[model samples]
Target chain A: MADITKSRTDTPTLWVERVHPAVWALGLVMLFMPAFANGFWLFQVFGWTFILGMIALSLMFLAGYGGMVSLIQMTVAALGGYGVAILGPSGVAQISLGLPWWLYVPLAIAIAALFATLVGALAVRTEGIYTIMITLAMASAFFYFTRQNYGIFNGYSGFNLVVPPQLFGVDWRQPVPFYYLTLGCAALAYAAVVYVARSPFGLALQGTRDNPRRMAALGFNVTAHRIAAYTFAGAIAAVGGILLVWQNAQIAPGTAGLPAVFDILVIAVVGGLRRPSGAFVGAFIYVLLRTFSPDVLTAFGLSNERFKMLIGFGFLAMVVFSPDGVLGLWDRWRARAGRRDPLTGKERG
Target chain B: MDGTNAMTSRLGAVSTGSALELRGVTKMFGALAAISDVTLTVRPGERRAVLGSNGAGKTTLFNCVTGDFLPTSGTIRLFGEDVTTFPAHERIRRGLRRTYQISLLFTGLSVADNVYLACRGVSRGRFSLLRPRRGDPLLTRSAELVEAVRLTAARDRLVSELSYGQQRQLEIALALAGAPRFILFDEPAAGLSPTERAELVAILTGLPSHIGFIIIEHDMDVALRVAESVTMMHNGRVFKEGTPAEIETDPEVQELYLGGGHG
Candidate 1:
């Protein structure tokens, strides 16, 4: 960038812009979360929410920042899950390479990122529904490829009991420890999304989203930015995938199924399509239904599978009421609040 | 492909080496010939206006030069480099920029961000995934450009919220961000009031003499005032080329272009 000078009053002089004091406070709170969450709720509920939310964050980043609605995020995550499965210790005979988790995790992320780049190069030219359809087609092909090719993906029954190894004298799979691990990673991914949103690359990407012709005319490579955004989104999804495998202790073809792919879309949209933090909020709501819906279904003399139906109803309501998701609702409500008094029904502004 | 052709015959203001030279550039859409065997040259830091009616291939010429559309058969040289095959972004990186006849902007972002992205587009720092968009040195350049375009008050506002005149000013500011060796403006005064057009003209005139420009405008008076030389185009060919004064007085040019310039 050119080294021109604007007003000193307008420009923020802070060099370390990513780490605000509040972020440190959030990190500190997250660091000590294990003290509050019991083992069952910690690993089975919140931990899974964080893991899925991280993956949804990748979609939110692409959809919100790049104006790209990719339906292949779960496919990318499944690729990462398979990476950990094939490359690490699992009960899949003749499949697991028994590599170190560190080695396998990075390898998984690389595979996912590579897949995303290829998909992006092929799909970036098409916009809106076409992009969604193309990515969906690719995702279906991948699912079939994994299912049919048992030599690597292990057919219908995927590698199971694939656990995280003890590192730094802590059993990583322990409920509290795993929850903390998931929280720490989730926080990092969240911070990264926020950071990237404020970065030069992110701004240029948003500019490309708004108007590619203008961005290209201004010397920014619009296609390159779009491709790079997908690659970045893939890496973030890969992280969620690794954590997901670590949490579930397995990997399978259904991981990247059509329903799973759209599940992420719902999670992202329900939270907010325009903000990163929305992913987490949406994931929490979705996971709550997953956790408690079985009991509710039983109380109503319905099958456990009906939980998804109930969730779908809620999802429909969310889409209809707040299409931009919760953040947009908040924005609308704030605007309304600014015009009317909060306690009394009188015009304020 | 020779630079010694009649394209550069008129020595305009700021005569450094040729900034852009097009030879035998032709573009066709099916049976329609948008540009046909047209050649032109632009010197560094010179203001040259393109005067033509609606179907005179003005936009097509600018598109081929800026790489928005590749010419079917041609050689476009930018700063002595053969750039006919270059992409739009690559051409921009090579110090060539242009504006759309209709304003195209990053409507989702602030005016400051729009200009800042333009400044940051060329530099290596645009890829940083963690840096702050605020406090960017490019933002300082953006601020300067905002002031130059008389958009300081609208700097923090969204592009969608700005009036049409403000949007046009922002369009010019975005082009200026790259500090291009050559800029091609397609109808800078297309949708502005008389007062706004005067302001737009003033902004273009206030630019440093070292900045080269190729402006295409139907407003002959404003185009002639900003430009040192004029290239009158007709049906995908250069009808005439001369200094603004010479073209204004030429009876042939009056019959072909200036007589119906308003519509």
Candidate 2:
């Protein structure tokens, strides 16, 4: 299992020994989760976690690898959801084009990716805080346009009953089936990001991030690489968006509002932007907190509306204490434990 | 096999014209003229050196030629094609390569990764999502480049872990990537030990005959040893152009530049 993380210089090993044991264990647990957990846990908790994690993972791809902290990922996801709603059959008979599931799915992802690429074309020209401002501005524009325009977007009412197609003779909206669906998509998206991180495109994107001038001198179109990164990330976010709309069977302008956009950024940051897995970890933590915090707040004689305050404080604490988030804290603990003598309980060095 | 042939064909096709030609190139920084009316030309396979003291606009001249800064006035051509308005990467894709004076490198990446990126930059599939397999030509080329720069032992090490001289060697390896017809080396031997300086000179002089280059150096020993011709600059102007022997023996050059006891 450890061979999977081996450096590129290492000799090739057997494929069976490549993956880590922990990964196999996690896979088994996720696969069998429906057997033990109830519908609420599968549908409301894990389903939402996987969906939000996928969106946050897109932002992580852009921010971590490309050094562009874009806040438009949520909006891109919303647009994807809207694409499915408007292009395929939905409750909104006025707009639904009644396209087949296969057709609408790809079209939705493509539209979202194209939107991201266009936004990236505009955003990559600027540096640092300006990128955040530009992406946020675009996200705001998309939200308002969706809210006001009644034609293509269906206006503020958005769309409802936008369910996933019935494939394999199973109702995909069922909690168990939906869990597997979201889990499969999230795993694939995670693997794709991890695999692409080492590809030529990914390496060059990181190169541009570290030193754009040097990359340009080396004959790389830094701007093109960045724009392409946004497109890739957008596709991932769009997939998540489609799942989200199906999970709730609805979507609105509020789906991609400013707060939601910022939420994805917060999720990625709180998970640790250094690694792809961090987004999922952050999303899981956020889902748990958002689900259980209201109960805890009410138990403590505080209004459930103050759940936001608790989340804000938790985020602040994470940033102030461990800027890299939960992963950094885990890493520090592991490093400390590694340095201690096992039997003597003393420092090794 | 096919990649090598394509490179050869590209090289053969562009073999006719001058490697680099700049006419009346001038660059200004608001109220200051960094380089003014600097006209220079290097023929195919020519080895030339630009010698000047600090503030002589030598770096600025390299910047203009590399498209790091667009000249306020003048026309630049590479392989007989006008490229005065081309971006840095566009010029680079046209076979113009450059090494920085300040050691610009991807410190977090491995040495091989850095060279691999340089090779991948000019090649097709710059946006490939597929990782290179074991027998990938770019990987082979990158490994060969690392070996050429004598850093194969540190190939897997992070660039930040390399010694200063090793970093400079890596810089040269990057510029040598792809089918470069012309290279602008900005002080390739700067701050090197005598042994490293010898290595730098060997690398510069051992390049193929079809590849021309302009070297900017404060080390006269290095500059004169590798370069056949010399262009001296003073106060943003061309002071003299001659062979290394002529520049070494010219009375005015001795009085103005070498008299300062530069080696």
Candidate 3:
């Protein structure tokens, strides 16, 4: 009777038993990566991947579960970064408030989340293409505002040397420590998204996405749910943004420019928007390509500037062949490989 | 002296007012009035049927009362509270429920998930981040609703996989979620098989006596069996109102609707 009541699609199970062996192996590899890899691989490659992955995961959370494709995630992240730089001590003494780390971190996340909630209230009023357009427009506005405003933003020559504080006699910016910090944060973000996907709020979000009118009839405030989703996604993106400022040791308008905003969307789509893990997978692929494509292009006697073209082609190929992203490709392959008659346990024709 | 009478009348309304009241409700689309000057009243626990032909504004009337589309002009009272301007969800929270004429279910979600969402919508903690524990009250309630709709065997299946009749049953279960004081069922029996229609009739007749409902059904058999009083509409206006027997026997009703082959 209990089994009959449970939904096969969303039933919660013991975490240890539900996770695949391959995932366990991957986790072990990530955990022990510092022993095998050098500082560059640990800090530059993996650190960047984790930060970008968290931001993209927020996008996946909204687009996959909420049916809202918001381009403002990257902007939210940048705002978070800017909050840290402006509130905490930085090279730009004129703008930096020189506040304590604990004080600035929560304040930064709150400001970004509040901005996202406001944007969500406006964006959810329209839907589909209009949502994308409105968020993109807001993102563009933020970019220009930061670039032009010297009062609070410090203008085009934004803050530099905005490093993470040394806590407990540990240099957090060290390559090994930074990798673990980002990996831990990214893992938490991923888990939060996965856990929330099965919560009542998440279920209702999917309901509103599928049928807003029916959801309203079911007594859900559809607009409020949608706006709340943006708030949650915004908080996740803000965390990524703070880490990103620490990673680069700087905060600039270019960090959340149009190109950067588009890159996060591309990463999410290429990874697959259906699951949280896809964000990390797509981020890893993007980081690998970005890091090596210049060398590969140069080796082939081609201009390194064509790396963007290469990435573009890769994105196009993924969309055309597996619009669900790399995960879709993997799923189809697994299905074909494992096809059999359930009753007979034999290969089916 | 006048204030005392007004207070007595207001208190009287709270105790004995109709379950649903529409006074001069009018809805217009451009130059066309879908339903104009429609006044209706249903007492507490009253089982009523709104019978109308196509374009007779039965659906339009349901939409107005449910707050799907606000009436262009007029007052709507739900259990004696003026709710003409309330949003759909607000009205639903106020013990009013409705089922769409066309099925409006979440096809991607499982049957249990669908019912769970309905149960969660009206209850508190709508935005809870925590998943329901085993044997949560709301989960148990949703399970009961699924069982009540006779979809227990298919509880794990998606709505898209359910048969047409099963989807219709799910629609009723969604409307029955929360403690509904009044329900508006729009063509609840449309496209149902004979067996399914009987099951629907049983469900409708089995509802608690305190919970009244207004049903708009094309099937006279099911409608007449379940509804004690029938309201007939023609050209968006109420042409007649009488008991099932009276409406069935009325010569004018026979010429315009029953004799026109709708029965």
Native-contact fraction for each model? 0.84, 0.75, 0.82
Candidate 2 lDDT over B30-145, as tens digits, reads: 98999889888899889999998899999999888888899999999887778899999888887889999999998867888899999998888899999888778888899899
Per-residue C-alpha lDDT of model 2 across residues A1-349, encoded as one tens digit per residue: 0112234558877755777798899989999999899999999999999999999999999998999999999999999999999999899998889899999999999999999999999999999999999999999999999999999988889999899999989999999999999999999999999889889998999899888999999989999999999999999999999999999899999999998898898899999998899999999998898999999999999998887787788889999999988888988998999999999989887
Q: How does each model score on TM-score?
A: 0.91, 0.96, 0.95
Candidate lDDT scores, in order, read: 0.85, 0.91, 0.91
Give the TM-score, chain B only, in order for the candidates.
0.90, 0.94, 0.93
Highest TM-score: give the candidate number: 2
Instruction: Give the range where candidate 1 chain A is weakest over 10 consecutive residues by summed lDDT.
Output: A1-10
Flag the better candidate by lDDT, 1 or 2: 2
Candidate 3, residue B43: how far the Cα is off, in Å: 1.2
lDDT of 3 by residue, A1-349 (tens): 0132343336666758767799899999999999999999999999999999999999999999899999999999999999999999999998899999999999999999999999999999998999999999999999999999999999899999999988888888999999999999999998898888888998999999889999999889999999999999999999999999999999889999999999999999999998888898899999999999999999999999898898899899999999999988998978976897777877788
Candidate No. with top DockQ: 2
- TM-score, cand. 3: 0.95
- How well is each residue in A1-349 modelled by candidate 1, as lDDT tens digits? 1121232335555545535587578667767767776898889898999999999999999999999999999999889888888988898859899999789888989998999999999889999999999999999999899889988898888889788877888988999988988888898999798777767898888988888887888888889899999999999999899889888898888888898999999999999988888899899989999999999889989998998898799789989998988778887987887899768978785
* Candidate 2 chain B: 10-residue stretch with minimal lDDT: B1-10
What value of lDDT does candidate 1 attain over all alpha carbons? 0.85
Q: Which stretches of candidate 3 lie over 4 Å from their true place?
A: A1-13, A340-347, B1-16, B260-263
